[model samples]
Target: MADSEQREGMHYLESLPRRWVTLYIPLLLFLFFLLFPFYWMGLTAFKPNAELLSTEDNPFWVVAPTLEHFKKLFIDTSYPSWMWNTIIISVVSTFLSLAASVFAAYAIERLRFKGSHQIGLAIFLAYLVPPSILFIPLATMIFHLGIFDTRWALILTYPTFLIPFCTWLLMGYFRSIPFELEECALIDGATRWQILTRIVLPLAVPGLISAGIFAFTLSWNEFIYALTFVSASENKTVPVGVITELVEGDVYHWGSLMAGALVGSLPVAIMYSFFVEYYVAGMTGAVKE
Candidate 1:
């Protein structure tokens, strides 16, 4: 009776069919749900318009794929410009936010000053303040500063949200590092800047990578600020340009739109592919460990 009772809850699936039913089936379903959109987008981007508009063909697979949509996207539109703007904005804002975050997080975590914990909490609270609440005021500020229609507006405004998030994330990472190392450096006549530069930074690479990825992703996808601050089509980022420019009144350019989305998403995907190791480490709380 004891043996049977223990086996009831603890026994693992012993048969191949049982494991397949319990594990592989669920995983396949989850993957289909997650990846179906990308697959559809790619299919639409390559499908000829006649085939796309036709109802008789199997929508699941493209009967014939062509590069016409891509050709139109690059040759007939300002996709290249939007791509450049997004890349510039995402990269510049990410670096700016990461730099400020590293300093702020180090000060908050290691400087050991009064109300440091309170300050950290305040930063987290600030991040919780949604962009919807902030955009109107930020619009006024951007207009007043005469940067409302330029890439600089996005580059500058993005840091407002990015800093708090990166700072909060890095604060936890910095706290995870040993304080004894800092103390030893101090005793050895190392200045605060030297310790931060030489000791802390090396250990914090994974955290920094994680923060950079977050900042970059947010800046790339931020729509409210981009739509509000930048009105010029030429200066628009991919998110705004793709949605706004591709739609004309009731007519939507589905093929071109899908192409833009597929192209626009490639940079972020590439970035993740390159830094996935550090990002996974950071999320798993394993930096410098």
Candidate 2:
């Protein structure tokens, strides 16, 4: 039945012209829009300053490509330190958020406590609160703790936003899991920790991956918090550091800026490319549940 349905769908676009107008053309246009930024950045990163400013050369294509921008970004700037700071903060925050989210999700979904539904709704609502508002109070707290202008500020404050969303995403996925399994384990005198470790966690790997990816990406790209919290050039994350350090008064290092952006985006892009399948499944499963 499915094969026949697929064949019927294919029949509508069987002709070359029909397929071109209905499928290939639109797909090509979408791909172009999606990938154009990366292409532009890559070209800009390799182009020399002269070609970049010259109207004589084609803007879309490179005339003389040079590695000087990359060299400057690496050798003359604190980009490496910024990158290391981003990695450490993102990874540590992601781990912390996921840990808290797991417990929160499991409790709300499986504990059968009073106001569980309300609590779950509240958690999701917390996620909807804008970071712009929360950052003010967070900044004060970080300053009071004497952790301002340090990587610890970002690592600690990031979970404030990350936990709520991760919890919400995980709650839905946890709901998709059968309650009967936990009930069976309970009858066998298994502890909650045991059941979680030996059963639920094993089954929830996709959900965990999805949550981890979301948390990591958010932490990596986070700018306002990183900027407001950390003032030191070496402590800034990629997003904040690239913008603050590369642009001076009425002058922008376009080549190095593009190089930093291009390089900065690679980690998240590679992560998505690898885990896209699981990410989709986790999102769909959670939403359906």
Query: lDDT of each model, Cα atoms only?
Result: 0.89, 0.89
Clashes of 2: 0
Q: Per-residue CA lDDT of candidate 1, range 1-289, in tens?
A: 9988887874474788987898899999999999999999999999999989989988888878889989988988888999999999989999999999999999999996899889988988887899999999999999999998999999999999999888888998898899999999999999999999999999988788888887788898899999999988899999999999988899888999999999999988898889887667654542232
**Model 1, stretches more than 4 Å misplaced?**
1-13, 281-289
Give the true-structure RMSD of model 1: 4.6
- TM per candidate comes to 0.91, 0.93
Across 25-48, the per-residue lDDT of candidate 2 in tens digits comes to: 999999999999889999999999
Best by TM-score: 2
Task: Itemize residue pairs with steric clashes in candidate 1.
Answer: none
Provide the lDDT at 106 for model 1.
Answer: 97
**How much does candidate 2 score in TM-score?**
0.93
